[model samples]
Target: MISGVASESSSQLLPWQQPIWQDLVRRQQQSGLPHALMFTGIAGIGKHELSLRVAHWLLCQNSSGQADGLTESCGHCHSCQLWQAGSHPDFMVCQPEDNSRQIRIDSIRKVNEFLAQTPQISRCQVVVIRPVEVMNTNAANALLKTLEEPAGESFLLLEAERFGSVLPTIRSRCQRIQLLAPSAEQAQQWLQASGVSPDQASQALRYNPQAPLQAQLWLEHNLGEQQQQWLDLFGQWTQGRAPLDKVVAAYTKMELDDVIHWYAGVLADALKLTLSVAEDQLLHGGWLAQLLNACGDGATLNKTKLITLQRNVQEIQGGLLSGAAHHNKQLLNESLLLQWRALLQ
Candidate 1:
């Protein structure tokens, strides 16, 4: 429970947390409304919150479905009360119920049942599904069937990480709204206020609020195990004896998403070693120095090689989007390190 706030239900959100509230309000007020909406963004970015607010708007007795542009739910209204209490029969929120880390068919089946009914307050019934792409084969099919036919005035809201992973059919049926990361300065101030130390604040803020700023702060402030994830790869990539297991295990910890950070630290150090940059204040100066000794670059790293590192980072984002792993992660990392090795050669 954040201070001075209600239970912080997924629908009520900080203004900066989501930038599209007014746009949503405008549509609600203007009476242009969709039967289904898809919200996509990083975790903790108020996807759930925004969806709830939309549900409230739909259920609001006074709402004409115009985008009021007020960017808020009427807290005094009956719809808002039911939503704030999470007791609205016409309102449903679904997420993975299984401890198995997947949103299974049974949960979505329940959503189908909920949508089949009429709204208690108004003609509109709102259903929200978080991490919606987790729907397995059968679940996705069940949802596809609903999308094909008319289902009264129900509005289905889904929040997913990889929007493309959702069935193309489902994507076609719903309008999508994307939320992005906060600015660096904004993120930095948020992290610091949350108690992150000055040394760790800068790196921690590089990722947006929804990207686990607090977790990154914890990792950076403490002498935690960042090396274990990549040390084996670093060792074997140099000797060319690196087993697939070493690379895979390292990647499982670091993941393709995190590759750029490692490169950012290492490459920044190489710049200093080459005298291209002053030594006083590298972000990861200590870690940078250590990687340089291991990778062996005297001064400015191979500019040609740094380009390859940049490319590898891009590929990681691509791999996540394409749902491809292993080969892509391995090829990207090993390929970049091989470029680094060439400088030593």
Candidate 2:
């Protein structure tokens, strides 16, 4: 079965989303809300959550608007109660099934069926299809039909990380809303507000630049310590103070994609240091000095080696994202580490 039936409601907008939210509300108030909207942004910037907020607002039965000129759903209302309970008749969400990345034709077909129905509870029916770029050609084409002839009071909210990745035909049919990540300062503030320690917040941002929510999740998972441990081991291995096999074994126990990403960050920092870039401009600026001291020779890595390693990490990251690393994760990790050792020579 196609996954993603219900959306968790968001009561507040992320700080960075205020302007976009206001613009959307103005359009909504002016009766200019489009039948379809495409929200595009990098991951963890709250595109999906923003869509849910808008959906909740659209589904809200509250007649009395907020005094702040922003309209939010009153949680006590019957429509909202139904929405929160995940049994709202007028709402549906389409996404990839479990263990899959691509949104198949079956899901889009279901969306078509859902859109064919009239609103049962509210003034409109809403469907949210996230990461729309993952839809296969057949699925995209199927969705295009619904976009072309949208049913009465039916709205489609589509999300994708890369706007250019979506089909042109589909792009033309929807109003595009692009989301930008918050500044580092803003992200760090938000993370601190969310109860993460200042140091942890900074480290998380280093691991996940411009994406505060992702950084927040990283902190929640207590992966910051894991990252530091991995970096220390990596430094030791690169310095020939630790065995490659043991380092690889330790990494295999962690999330491979994150491990690769952190490794890429280390290489990037090394390149920056080699080029005499300011420490403040570095991603791992706080821990970099200590890390370099630990890395020894790895810290003074030439730009050529660093760039090559960066490219290798990028390829492995792409493989992970494309689901190509599922079965060959061990091989991929070993190959990357072996190449790291080779570049040290």
Candidate 3:
């Protein structure tokens, strides 16, 4: 497990964060802090950021100074200084080890040990764990004991992008806060302010509506161009202009998982269009229509075929993520590509 002390930062809350932050601050002011607080939201929506801010707020020496407006950690105070220096004794964060993504039982045990000790500086001890769903069953079970009977003035802050995937038993013990995405207009404006073009912002938002940071990074990496190139190659292959072997060779040189995901997005859009789903539901939207006009004919857009393709793509993606190397890379790409080609035909 990776352990660290919480630190004070100059980062301000995003627009989507205001509601939840306000509520937490209100609770703190009322002296109604939850011993275990769960912050659940989509990835890249700043759940961890909000959690850290809350930690700093609770640990700040001058927390009472800002009751009228936005509360902040008095960065000049002793407590804030300790936090800034990463030597704060009252705060701790637990995470998965770099080599092993799983948060094992030993890590949770360490947390249990930390909580057992009296607060070193601040009156309350704080612990933060991110993406807590990565914790194995044993680790989670160990954590449940601490949650059931938290000792002293200790607080546990947990963040999960996929909250539903976390154990229900764990969920029941904590006070949950769900963060929703900002409106489309807000997301687009934020992206534009960050120097993304209108079209690029729209494309990225379509890919992941609740994750503006991910969308911005997607545009930064020029994945929109990559998507276009992949679609073009697929179109050519469908028309017998580009050979399957050539496309497979191209894919082998690029990130395999990303390619699969992009294809999955396109297929998903096509399926939605085939079912006459609302236009807003599509990731590609008008771009999908244009692509279909130039390439796809909806001949292979049946629900069963689309679902099967999605499932297969997810399975392959999972395998790749889990370090699947038993099969030859080129051969695997060729097989997947041929399957896609057949579906298109």
Candidate 4:
């Protein structure tokens, strides 16, 4: 069994988590903890973080229990120390394998073995399975057995961005908590606290909306800069100033999904401009001025062609991210970019 809690820094519950925290505490007090729980929310909203927080609290020996209604672990406790050291025997985390990106039968078998044993440190064993939907059919079936009749004081914490994709059998076995994005005001505050400037935070929020963590990553990684690079390259390719081979090579080197996301933003801005929509409503509003200055107004844009390209982008992104065993990704990406280049003409 792979044993450890999520990193200590990200395991603390956020301000937006108060409602769910209080609800879980009340549930624990009223009827004890559920054997299995499904933490469902949009991607990058800290669902995994919340799961880690719960696991830490449950396994912490010096924790403020249901009586005190705390949402965090006592960091000084031996259990917490063991967790921080990444050797807590009672805590097992299962995730998709590195290459396949799917939880396989082998991992689930280890979970079964782990669940059969008694807790080594705390009174309970905590198991975290992230993106539970990534479990293959066999792996999901294997897990269903444990969820159906959980043995000992074991708790299953399953995090999923898409609850519907999880096996219905597994979903039925666990108590589900549907987490929502924090309000705009709360998200903005969190962004500012993370050192994002007011203007940039607003732009990120506009770009990503409901997902503060994703927006933060976008800023931290300077994805905007990367997007600009792609935009400029595409423009050059369209104007016959850059070689298509090099452009394709550069695109295939970066993450395809992020490139697709950036393409979607660019296409959306073009669409909005074509329809004479307000600039403030554009997702790439921060880059709108430069985009228009370089790419010209959307007046001459072929809406049908843009829509077709957008659909192709989605198709390519979905194909690449499906975690298949093998694919001709380079050729596929090159062809897609060629199509996009043609559309620019």
List the candidates' TM-scores in order.
Answer: 0.63, 0.87, 0.81, 0.89
lDDT of each: 0.63, 0.79, 0.76, 0.78
lDDT (10s digit) by residue, model 2, range 1-345? 343345453546899999999888877876558899999989989998899888878888772233343376777788888878778888888888876777889889999998898888777888899778878788999998899899887789999887886789989999999999999999999999988889888888877889998988888888877877887787677677888678878988877767777777877777777787898887767465665566565454556876888887877776565433454556766777777766542
List of clashing residue pairs for candidate 3: none
CA error at residue 67 for candidate 4, angstroms:
3.8
Query: For residues 1-345, could you state the per-residue lDDT of candidate 3 as single tens digits?
Result: 555555455235787788888778887776668799998887777787788888887777777623453376767778778888878888888887755656788888989999999987777888998778778788899999899999898899998876776889999999899888788998998899888789878879887776887787788788778877877777677567888888887777887667777777777777777788887787766655564566645544446766787788777765544332244668877776676656553
The alpha-carbon lDDT assigned to residue 301 of candidate 1 equals 50
**What clash pairs does model 2 have?**
none
Q: Which of 3 and 4 is the better model by TM-score?
A: 4
Candidate 1 local distance difference test against the native: 0.63
Selected candidate, larger TM-score, 1 vs 2: 2
Candidate 4 residue spans exceeding 4 A from truth: 1-5, 63-71, 286-299, 319-322, 325-327
